[model samples]
Target: MAKNNSRNMSDQSSMNGYIKSICDIMRRDNTKGAMEYIPELTWMMFLRILDEKEEDEHLQSEAVGEIFEPSLKYPYRWRDWGSPEGKKRKELQEGHMDDFLNFVNDDLIPHLKSFEEKTNATKRQKIISQIFRNLTHTRLGSEKNLLDVLDKVDHLTSENIDDTHQFPLSQIYEGLLLKMGEKNNDGGQFFTPREVIRAMIRAVKPDVKHNGEYATFYDPGCGTGGFLAENYTYLTTPEISDLKLNASDYNHLKHDGFWGLDNSFTAFPIALANLVLHGIDQPHIGLKNTLSGRETYMDLFEGAPYKFDYIFTNPPFGGKEGDDSKANFAFKTGNTQILFIQHIIDHLAEDGTCAMVIDEGVLFRTNENAFLQTKRKLLDECNLWCILSLPQNVFVNAGAGVKTNLLFFTKGETTEKVWYYDMSDFKVLKKNPLTINKFDDFLMRLHSDKEEDKISEKSWYVDIDTIKKKDYDIKAVNPNIKEKEIPKPDELIKIIEESQVKINESLQKLKELT
Candidate 1:
């Protein structure tokens, strides 16, 4: 066990070093920020990882007596272009900078994009085309910097995956995501905090015991595939649980039980890279705008009216869908959040479960027909069981100050009563964000039939009738807590100063006694 721990630490250290090297190269290259650096960095990393996976796949196939079709020919593979001996690297070292750059932009990208036309192409191959279709050479305009980045990425290999000296590539990729998500632009849309993802996964419990072999998970607006990656991790990792299952169930889930969709051209590749690091060799994340129409991505939903057993996502909010996109939904709304909720209702299977992070406006906004109708359908068709009112700072890092709630529900049952857990009092901020440990009190109350203790002061339930009387308003109001008394800024400052003085006096007296 000690030896294993040592090896893991070594692996972690090595991986972190590689990531630091890449970031250093990015900085030296004058890449703008994570928004510019990550995508360009990811494009190179994707090819390198894909090449390694292909090698592993080929070896496994040979052992199993199966044929492994190669995606890229001799010079096109990462081993050919990315390694030290590779032509691109050699050319860059020899001062043939234009030659190397032109080959990548002119030959390499076009070749990758041509995979869509390959006859009998594997699904992975098709995805390669989909991923590289819009990919442009964003960074790495400098040949020497590009070579430096490639050299760093080339050090990442499966053999070093768990070595104590190396950081796992997945950790590095997620780190880039964290950086990219700090952008206040559209790039920030791809990040939902991993803690939030884990909380939702724990609440929904998407696993084989509940869903069985047909167990499947889908994310309609899967930003950078965080939920899907975490969901896969949750199902595969063994723990004491209520679910009855075996190794095969876990295996099935690891390989074939997840799908994600996002329309953003930029986000799709990052999502693919994220899932790839999670050991999903061929993730079924579609790149279509989910709101474009119900008929969109028919290939993904064959039986179609409702296909997913578990749906989890944080849909893009505060934006209106175009009229062309709105025409597809029954609840004709320009509101992106409403349309996504409607889409979830449409694609969700009978007995399917969903845990989504929705804008706070979704709870009580009934002014528009689209908002009211969507909420009405949600209550009428699903067992809208829980609304976890998150703190405002939950998304502060992602540049969103708009409040959000985690809505957990099952599809087959009608809403009777809704459980509301108000976490607003947690006082979380970007630096001291809410962690999964903080969710234990709420989860315990949810799992047990026992009502919230008056002392706990942050949970309560409301009947469906009461909700209907109030138009399904789901804001969490902890009846046990007394209304807060507002204090002026000056008064609050005086109170803080008084408290500090008392604390200092107590400390001074204790010191004198000692």
Candidate 2:
């Protein structure tokens, strides 16, 4: 999808202002927190976008002399309940506001919820039913506020500006997710920064056309489907256009190429809405704790290790998988990261590639049997190709202080050599966040031969013999940067004396005051 329209700051601000107005309505209505506002806003946006798309498709069908079978009945359609010219809006303005809200509460939602019961429902209908099933209109205050919010939503067009390349609904949706994570109370646990998602996608380079089969990507711990969405864009971009894919190829790719799982009750709908707004008519995101094993989607994975062609994710950290989930893995670890690592290895296709972020503890913790066994299996079964020690500030907004590394590897090849890139010194702040350009040199080096790939003092490689002797610890230690020497006791005393005079002067001044 080539974007011929270019969006300037003014267009973005106008749309953002609209979003801000919606949030203001929610806040005024006492919608409680970001948790409430996010879901509320997402569902509203989903309906609005869906209606616009349906109308366009219906017109096209009519133009081609085909009957447009609408997914919703006339009374349940967005134009019926959501548009300004609709009966509901006219009644809402004329003091039948409660009647309109009652219809939405008692009638509209129930109709939407019935999609799951239809034996012949399409994937899109099922997805709609799943989202509404998990959703509730909690703490939405008053009908007046709802009408006000609906009016603001009605102002949004599918495409903002036609000539100047204004932001589309997709960008608006992405921005809202970012806002939910950044300014809302959610702490964005389900949202990985876009920069990190793109980097992981670039590293894995998943291609449906090149694979000669129905290529797929999975994120076992998909928080709001960031990795999966980024991967979808990668496969459809013009850079991969040389494959000469037609419309049906893309249609297949959009519906089947992505799979995601998450345990969050809150994240499921958000992820579904995110994917739907991004033109994935039927997203394959399911609700499951990647490690929980509590519920199953036998239809999708066939009750076995459903291997995907590529696996890319940033699994939740600073938590532990419970005993029941731990029982499912060979390593038998309570650690969440380790269990996800094992799960990915088991479910990755024979030639599958995976790029994930892991806590630094997984790289150096040799005390636990589970950890050691994980490292052993990773080394023996896969070629662990690269490690990038990321700067801590990269995840500071997520409250992550533990040093993390990006691990890229493929199955069915024993490790021979591993490239290490030390980016600890790379400064990143919230205001000056990491960007795709920052990883340009690293990505270039990633594809080149070892001899030609050297970038600076931060890049190096460790052979398999060295790794084996070190017991498979893959932490990057830059050989090029010389270590600093510690001072002797006498030198330490001299350093203390240098600061003692100022300390004594301050103490004496305090004594005089006393």
For TM-score, the strongest prediction is 2
**Model 1 stretches with alpha carbons more than 4 Å out:** 1-17, 85-97, 161-167, 183-186, 209-211, 239-251, 294-305, 397-401, 449-455, 485-514
Write down the lDDT of every candidate, Cα atoms only. Answer: 0.75, 0.76
1-514: candidate 2 lDDT, tens digit per residue: 1122334324666767668778888999877566678788887888887888888889999999999887776777777788778875576557654777777787888878788788887667777776787654434658878878877777666444332332266667777777656633464677777887787777766677435777777889887777877776666665532355578778876677778888777788788888887777767877777787765332333333378888998877777778889889998888998888899899888878999988888898887888888988998899999999888756653565677889999998998988888888877776767888888888878877767666578898899889878876778888988889999999999999989988999999999999
Which TM-score value belongs to model 1?
0.84
Model 1 deviation from the true structure expressed as Cα RMSD, one decimal place: 6.4
